[model samples]
Target: MDDPRDPRRDATSETAGNDDFGNEGLTSSDTLELEFREALNLANWTSGNRLQELGERLEREVELAARHESEMAPRVLDILRRNLASAEGASVESGVFQLKPEIVLNALRNVLFNGLVEASDGTRVTVATLPVTVVQIGVCLTSYSGDGDGGSIGHRLFRHDIMRRNSAAEQDVIDFLGRRRRRGMDTSAYGDDDQPMGISDMLCRALMIYGERAMLLERSERPWRLGHGGPMPHELIVGSGRKEMAFASLEMLRKLLLDHKRFIFVPSEISDQTVVTIANSLQPLQYAVLRDTTDIIENYVQGSSYERPHYKRSGLYQAVRSFQVDAGSKVLLCVYRASAIAPGRVFYAHEDHVHEAAQIVIADAALQESRGFPNLIDIADRTCRGMFEPGGLSAQVHATLARSGSPFRFLEERRTRP
Candidate 1:
């Protein structure tokens, strides 16, 4: 028979012969079959080379994907973990209400006048509710050199509020301040004289006032271990128009509360609207407004009947300056036209709660004339609103006072109930 697997034959014939011989004894056809097999092996080798190239490419792609995932996974996990921790920390236990650190910090910086709480074991806690409040206050003061030109205290306050609300203005102030800093000149143009108060000085003063109040409130015996306790209900006083003198009074109050470590002094700024709102909001908490715009003795009327009486007298500022001397337990001194009555009034309401007071100040029409006055009000208002919502600083103060382990008794003496 002709060699079926002959290399000279058609390729189909070689395939047929290989299938037919299948392990039979070697013949002339077997030699031809071996050559055919060699050709088939060469073709398989070439195809395998192509597949190997494709496999290598696939392997490289897989390695790249794995590397990318490896790089990104930790970051994603960390974010998720932080979120979980925050959520967990914010959660309140049944029948137990606790303030969050952010809320506490905000109260310290803006409303509470920078109140701090140091634990008995020497853990110092600075309460700040919104990080932006710090940044906003910092930037607002940074624009001023404590000069009269930046505007009156009222104008400065107003500008601060307006700028805080207006994003464009804020950016401008920041940019202007940044450029001034780079140029090594004064950033704030408004001041009493050319020797404007630096923003850093203002910030330091504000922070010092806040820290002082916190230290006093916490009743720390040691200077280094200040702010170890919470607010004392009996020591709290909420009023309006006593801004500047309040800081000085706070010095006295610090002594009063600390000498009696169990006592807490809380000072608040309230407007006519705030008085009514707080009265309505904090139901069952005894409410009274001392219309002491005249002499300290004349303003002290007795009974709950003295709801919203107007005082026809000057020196209301003088009376407020001295009001702290007789303030017994929590007192809410609500004044009408606080800005009109005392334009540059400075008071403390837990540094964190200052944002609310700042809001009130900024909203006053009188502040419009003051440079930078309106800016902080809007910024503080937005921040306070965002943080406390339906319940603002008043709510926070009330809650803190309640938790302060002091007996809160509102006094309404018929002889001294203005």
Candidate 2:
């Protein structure tokens, strides 16, 4: 009736008729856009949850891989154990083993550098991944220290004996001794004019300082103690008279044992009669008589029956002969000494054992050296050939030289030409 084709009439009719439902089309489109945005947000939330789940799964897999690797560690160690057994001069008895020089040398290298586990102390074990040759040189150097002058000459000559020996360690020993000498002037307590301290006294001081330092470096490192949980046997060689020194040494040792509650002093010179007397006197600590002469050790081995608790043996002679050139005789003496000392524990007849125990040290040194390895084979050849000349300094130098062929030749040529 309002004439739909007429613009003014149509507008007026539309406005009046639909005023309550105005803009219904625009409202419907706005509702649809809001629904679409809500759907998008939900999808995004689902994707985030999936990503978090994936990340957690990857972390678990990594942990599992590490665990599997750790579990396989022991199996890998078994291979090294077999290789050690087959090495030359190794004796395996009931799965227990003993190593001769060459074998021992190799074993040390394997443990220190080659990644072989030598021994464990609950928390961690010492591994040898170092070259065997390098360990040999370290042993040689340690032995040289026993030859007097604190191994200064030997250290210099053997500087290049190992390919990876720790130069810093060598320098440390040098610097420490140098500083000690220097400080003597500042402090009258350790002056040269002071009467030389007894060996036992010196040992006590050394042990205290060494123990403290060792504890600081490695808190788990334990002190040497006896079966009753007392200190290890230590003696002080005092005075020129052997018997007097022995008696004083024993008395002081006993006192230390009593005071420390963990030490047993093995007298360096207790005879059969004295051994019995000392055993009777000392209630808690075990006793061992240290014989200076070979005859005394032989007498105890042959004469003493199983009735005596204290063992009698020659320690000084064994220490000396263990490093001698004549292997046949020296080896025999070492065995004899070991038999007399203890049937069970690993008795170190030669300084070689010490070298074997610390084989990694040499390898570490070699790594630090310019040439990069300890020349132990050369050292052995030179030692066997007696290429090392003899003099006070020469003996020390030769001992060091004997541990490395290249260094020995270089030093020898230098000496000859000079």
Candidate 3:
């Protein structure tokens, strides 16, 4: 028989084993020793007023952030007003910005009940209970190197797929799956950098190229291409690339910033502090924190070097205007936090259209298990992962090289660690 109140028995039990000491029971003196060591280790840091000083320092940072929001909000709003005024299709009411929660709710209500989503450009899409068409792009890469002074090479794969779902039937179309092999050091890349590019950079270029290609295919005369009306359907394109609208590379961002096609690019993740600050500033009284779309800030430069010669001379802006959209009722969806686009450069040209785009994203995201990300993109990502699994290409290449009777030992591991 075991004593239920025995601490050592509980600690040693298979189902209730202790994490730190395992099944070993600690004596009173051993516990005292641990406490003494902990106190000794923290003595200097916990001594005088160190904690108070640290708290004060953190509070100062918070205060600075608050002050930054206060000073920057008006400047950003002024820029939006100026840009809207200069745009060709600017309305008389374009200067007025909507910051209230009721306005957003009204828009959402109309979308849910009226079943008619009217874009600012007068493109009215009759809403079904679900998306009539869904498009998603996926990309994956694997790299291999000769076990010598020779450089590495990379193989990349990209897939563009569309799914049509309605009451009648559901159909899937794998439009294209592109495959490319490139030297790791190739510098004739998208951005035209003079320096040799790495395998990771090659992967980024693949994503950008694949995304652009997907868009091109969408506009093609294929029977299943999007936005053709009559027989062809209208759909939103989702990408499994960068969480930011910028995608992975700058050149693709430049094209997206300059082109005004029927598209919406939303970042699946939000990490930029400036974007968070913008969301915090315009947070409305009705919604939970940072759940509403923000007033657009035109020509939003991403990094600090917007004034540099490389960017300024070519007018290449890495970042465009962005808005926050928290689709989750109480918590944030894991896939994305916000979306952004070029000012006056996308088909969703005006604020109302941008808001409509956000609403559409929220609606499609609701149908998926993730609750916040579009299902088609998630499906495409999974399909790509399944098809182009890690090391799958590498293993085949290594086997082929082995059978080719290469003189050099090319498949040797560079480094090994325990």
lDDT of each: 0.30, 0.28, 0.30
Candidate 2 ranges beyond 4 A from true positions: 1-69, 94-418
Candidate 3 CA-lDDT value: 0.30
* lDDT ranking, high to low: 3, 1, 2
Model 1 score (lDDT): 0.30
Expressed as tens digits, the lDDT of each residue in 1-418 for candidate 2 is: 1111122110111111223333456675796787678878765344754788768878987886555544443333343334534543332210112222343245345443333211111011111111111101111111111221111111111111123336699776675555445432332112234432222233333233223222212231222211111112222222122323334433443333323222111122223543233222211111111211233223323433312332224243332222122221111101101111221111111122222222222332233233222223223223422322223344444455568653445343446674
Alpha-carbon lDDT of model 2: 0.28
Candidate 2 C-alpha RMSD relative to the actual structure? 35.8
In model 1, state the lDDT of residue 3: 18
TM per model? 0.17, 0.18, 0.36
Q: Tens-digit lDDT track for model 3 on 1-418?
A: 1111222111111122223422268775887787688877755355464679868878987886556545664454444434645544343323312323333345345542233321100011111111111112233221111221111112333221222234543222222111122333333222243332222332343343444333433222211111111000001111111223233333332333223222333333344554444343321111111221222222133333444665445433322222111111111111111112111101122222333443333333344423344333344344344554544545554455558774235533542223
The local lDDT score (0 to 100) that residue 83 gets in candidate 3 is 66
